[model samples]
Target: MSTAEAVPKMHKACVYDQPGTCSIAIRDVPTPKPGPNEVLIKLTHSGICHSDYAIMMNTWRQLPVPTQTGQIGGHEGLGHIVKLGEGSEKLGVKIGDRVGVKWVASACLACPPCTESLEGYCFNQKVSGYYTPGTFQEYVIGPANYVTPVPESLSGEVGAPMLCAGLTTWYVSKPTVPVLGAGLGRMIYRLPELTVTAVCELLIQNMINIICVILEYSALLKCGASPGQWVVISGAGGGLGTTAVSLAARGMGYRVIGIDMPGKKQDVLDSGAEHFIDVTQFDDATIGKEVKRLTGLGAKAVIVCANSNKAYGQAVSMLRFGGSLVCVGMPEGEQVSIANAYPSSMIMAGHNIVVSAVGNRREAIDVMEMAARGVVKFPVRTVSMSELQSVFEEMSQAKVTGRVVIDFSAA
Candidate 1:
């Protein structure tokens, strides 16, 4: 509501000066003027995604480069639209309207992927925090077509993660109707059932907590899941895993069996998982045996939200005949083709394996609204924007439990 004259001359931003180095500084860059069909947002809070840390650390080489020099590094941004650019009227965006900017900033409408609403893989797409200046800065320019509108009910902080992590899971965890008499059809149970053998390698040892990121919990409540359906959630204490457990169990009325370390049992139970498996202490073979014992026919579907080769292999081994394995996590190292060795026989027996990179955006508005209504809870730790560098360090070391959000208001 304030005039341009009332705004500060310069705002603080966290910039990646080089691959592996991030610094917070007050820069005198001019306020970015919005382009045609674009709107300017004054961001309040942004979630520090693990992928952002990966990009900053140059852990992955596939990221886009929009600037040869340093660039801003954040994608999950929730803020208010404070200014309109030329031709923005056609976009239907308004001043003070809360909105979110995500990784997929804009996609060329002419692309084949765009035509199919598969903008996540749009060939000529621009990415925030990668190819474009992202939300780490106080003000950001967002394209009309791709930006997410935050509803009036949710706070900016709670709405931030939905643009990325939440969307990824929303896309992967959606229920599928298996062919009748197939793996899921054989179960003949009312509630959705999931079975998986979870194995976690102890790369780092600490009392790490789990955090779940949700767009909206109430929308998930309306999904019509019933009791007795079994849902297996790996990384059940982490952001994505916890959210899946909460929605699948608490909101949808499904029975949740959490897969994580034994120490994470309390947190997993707190998130509504009916059972917990201490994955760190178990071996792959042990997990498979345990899964078979827990679910007689095996799990109907397995949602792979953790990014590890071991997890993928375990997921494949744990699935029952004709069951589905939904791939959500990406490999941190070289992209490897799905191993043929694990369940070579399962495919022949009618098993289904599916991969989804990001959740459907059309569902985001509804999902975020659920959080606003207090139907779903997002557990997060608020950190000052100035602590971003250290946060990355903690993330790299696996010392953090749950999601770490950067409070830009501290700037």
Candidate 2:
């Protein structure tokens, strides 16, 4: 193993001392050496996402198991490599290089999802701060090939949230092209003379002219709206919501309508939303009607970024004909489907409902580039390790605005 400096045997980490509650405790844990194709990172900052709070409180019902006691909890980590495992240099990562760990900590590249450029949903994925050891510590190990390189111009504090919140919301407003030749094997089986290479070349040539049409029809374009179209962002004042608002408005040219409590109005507007709706002042029916009135025929898309079940229930009603509802937030407690999605209305309106996981590695890099260019900026508040519990409490009450990042240097 290659080392940049003297390695320490122990490091400080924040752990969930009591799982299923908003409690955190700091402890000195033994640091381990990096295995083959891995590198040890000395984390400098970690963004506290609502997903982390969900894991800590055991609120997300979809998780296979409850979070164990003493588990470290954080996924959006930015740090520098301190040690490299055997053969890790082959991956072009070295000691002292800055990298970030994402929600999908590691994915087996040979998996079906990974092969299709959807590593975020890999079957063998290791989710940071879930069952896997996460980045709430001063030191953690990450796969050399999977770690995302941090741009020199992006500060660690700003880059930390981009790994999760920014990545998850960045792609909501952008268009996603469907993978070419998705079911070409079935066609080849029927016609043996057609080779894969020739078929791919023909498909590529034929697809060039219809790319714009495909964008409208592509199932992968979860938020199916073009530039200047109205897009409603529910829960648009929280960490994930604000980031989504900024990327949708400033980065992608969409007119954003942010919905949240009256307290979050300034933050939502500051994040670049053209209009803000205070949920406390309006009922679900009134909110839907207001959105329709503001957007003329209703919004072209609705992105539910809040974890509230009520937000999901009201989202479908705020869309125009052929509009999409991109679900990004994970609601706590029992799982529930979108409340207002009636089959009769959905079929007539040609509405689509899709859920988005944290983005793939390519999207992660793109979000970092967006931040580096100043096209998107996170309103961040840096806090010490001891303040983690209070942060979670505020997050649960929906009182926290923008993003809260933990500065490990303070630990």
Largest TM-score belongs to which candidate?
2
The true-structure Cα RMSD of candidate 2 reads: 7.6
Instruction: List where candidate 2 sits over 4 angstroms from the true fold.
Output: 1-3, 177-221
- Worst 10 contiguous positions by lDDT, candidate 2: 178-187
TM-score of each: 0.81, 0.89
> Best lDDT goes to which candidate?
2
Residues 128-147 of candidate 1: C-alpha lDDT, one tens digit per residue: 88868888888888986667
C-alpha RMSD between model 1 and the true structure: 10.7
lDDT of 2 at 303: 94
**Superposition error at 333 for model 2 (Å):** 0.3
